[model samples]
Target: MKNDRGNSSGSKSWGMMALFLITGAVLGGILGEFAANSSFLTGVAPYLVKQFPIFDLPPVTVNLYVIKFVLGFALYPNLMSILGIIAAIVLFRRF
Candidate 1:
């Protein structure tokens, strides 16, 4: 019975973890931007602010004479974003 309860909650926990990770990445990116502009951290700003594209889905267009639909996806993870993901995992585990 205890094992069954754990399994059921695991799915929800995974969802929450993803949410936290995304939130952390966004917040960290914003912070990274500010840090990049600050004079005090100029030495390390360049490294932290650099962005590398992990994946980029070419835009696909569907035209039907009257309208068109475009779809695409991309992932560019910077150093700060990676840090954010790690921080998010740590925070989630702590809670």
Candidate 2:
């Protein structure tokens, strides 16, 4: 086996960390939206109904809209980033 100085363990660690960060961000957004009583389905449900003229349901409440925006746009993104960085540090330390 040739000793490849070009392929350092740190590079692998960083790559793994980046992957974790991305996943964390996505999960955080989803979870935050859920916690805030937001629905990915509901958000687009009205538009679909309008376009297709099916499921004649009322518009989503303002409270839900507020919650969803807060969670999906504000809280989740920041939390995810923080969590991702922490996770990366922990994982890197282990390796």
Candidate 3:
């Protein structure tokens, strides 16, 4: 008899990647904002404080047989967020 099992490392899901990126982006943005506010990192402050094109999804209202739902999502990407994303990619690859 042969053992059956999927590759442990290859089994990582998309959700994990999303979580990692999101966490990194939020933390990096917070740190960047704080750094910019303190006027210490003025050199890179412009890049840290500025956000690129924001992604806004219009709210969706749906009613189905006495059920109602509303959902929406938005993404605000900044330089720090971009850096965080790159870090995430590097981390994902290393794992």
Candidate 4:
């Protein structure tokens, strides 16, 4: 009975970790898309402009689609999984 309980608890933890990872991937992809498309970084652009005052300050171009693709395909999933593992380890240690 104790062994069965442990197995069930472990499975539950795994399921929760999977859910967390999926959520993180979706959020990261959305953020990457926003980062790529929006001129939201314009405020920071001036700082770079100041650093290179002599050169013409061209606007920073982020390709939202490319960012979306990369994050969706490569980055987000991996990053989320790693983060989830780290979090699980930390929480387990604390407990």
Candidate 5:
């Protein structure tokens, strides 16, 4: 009924939000990398160079006779990249 329709729309909204977040993260990362290498952007490059979660954590690694697995996680945020995420959130809320 109406409730079901509402639930369907909610799920779609969630999907859209996920897509937006992923897009923002990827775009931000790309910009950060570019800034790091491009001397022209030196003024803003420092902000983009900052890697968040500044501390190191040991990655989980498992090795077996026939297989090996490694899992790692980190959050590195630079100024413009963080702004990108904020912009994404703003867009998400507005839309």
Candidate 6:
């Protein structure tokens, strides 16, 4: 008899994709910075390291009688970082 369980060999969770994307973004940003600073890559610096803010959530504070909380969010992506995200997606699909 065939197995009733779904195929697990090819499936990947969203959490894994998120983790990969975040890691890719961080590494790409770092590489972009290094490229920007490296004299050998001066010509490509302008294309790689310029960050454009896509979202900004200013800090907000909530205070209760006994507790307080602060929250915020921001997204600033550069060209190389965007490329990194794409690369991550490709890698995720391949694996």
Q: What is the lDDT of every predicted structure here?
A: 0.87, 0.49, 0.78, 0.46, 0.74, 0.88
Question: How much lDDT does candidate 3 score?
Answer: 0.78
lDDT of 3 by residue, 1-95 (tens): 32233445456668878988888788778877887887668887887868876889989999896999999988878888788778887897677
Residue range 17-70, candidate 6, lDDT tens digits: 999999889888988998999999989898899899999999999999699999
* Predicted structure with the largest lDDT when compared to the true one: 6
- Range of the 10 consecutive residues with the lowest summed lDDT in candidate 5: 1-10
Q: Estimate each model's TM-score.
A: 0.82, 0.36, 0.69, 0.34, 0.65, 0.84
Model 2 lDDT per residue over 21-42, tens place: 6766566445444544546566
lDDT of 3 at 26: 82
True-structure RMSD for candidate 1 = 2.9
Model 5: CA > 4 A from native? 1-15, 35-41, 54-56
Q: Arrange candidates by TM-score, descending.
A: 6, 1, 3, 5, 2, 4
Off by over 4 Å in 2: 1-11, 38-76
Stretches off by above 4 angstroms in model 6 are 1-9
Q: Name the runs in model 4 displaced over 4 angstroms.
A: 1-12, 42-95
Model 4, range 3-33, lDDT digits (tens) per residue?
5646544344666566655665455445444
C-alpha lDDT (0 to 100) for residue 29 of candidate 2: 47
> In model 1, how large is the Cα lDDT of residue 15?
84
Give residue 79's lDDT in candidate 6 (0 to 100). 86
